[model samples]
Target: MAEGLFGVHAAALEVRSQRMGVLASNIANASTPNFKARDIDFTTALNAVESQPGGVGADLGGAVKYRVPTNPSMDGNTVELSTEQTAFAENAVQYQSTLAFLNGRIGQITRALKGE
Candidate 1:
């Protein structure tokens, strides 16, 4: 029952949260020399987790990858501040949505258990 409740959204939420962290790191290092921006392939990571029998938790370290910069910097830094900010914002929204879904699922489960 709990496993079904957290099936896909749990994995998606973890991926989104990991992506947000990566985007934040990229934004934070935008001014640093030769700092390469990194991100996760959300679909791939989510798929991997969802394919597993156990519902995915917060473990998302291996899904990280380097971002290909549209405009390469002279200092070899790939951290584009605007792009990173946009990605971060999008990921944050997705994370919130997933969280809401999880909360709703929990609420439904609670209500059902109470026979309400």
Candidate 2:
């Protein structure tokens, strides 16, 4: 489990961070003349990451399919700004937590290396 996490945790964190950024952008542009709301299918992205050898992070060139709107806005706006912003905030918190754990793991490794 530790090995898997050590390899994949970073990938999960990165994907989540990417999702947060996209969601935040969507929210920020919500009032920008009919922007349509965008969302990341986190489940799909996670699955995609898990399926790849060493996880998707191993292949930075690999493309993950986004949850694009099947029904786009008439004004070419797809961002539902409020929803995106809320999601962004939530994801950011999660990202921070994940980072904390990853950092903690690194700290533990450092201590172990020092024979602490």
- Looking at model 1, residue 63 earns an lDDT score of 72
Clashing pairs counted in every model = 0, 10
TM-score of each: 0.87, 0.71
Span of ten consecutive residues with least summed lDDT in model 2:
58-67
Query: Over the full model, what C-alpha lDDT does candidate 2 score relative to the true structure?
Result: 0.68
TM-score (C-alpha) between model 2 and the true structure: 0.71
Displacement of the residue 83 alpha carbon in candidate 1, Å: 0.5
Worst 10 residues of 1 by lDDT: 52-61
N/CA/C clash count, model 2 = 10
lDDT of each residue in 86-110, candidate 1, tens digit only: 8888888889998999999999989
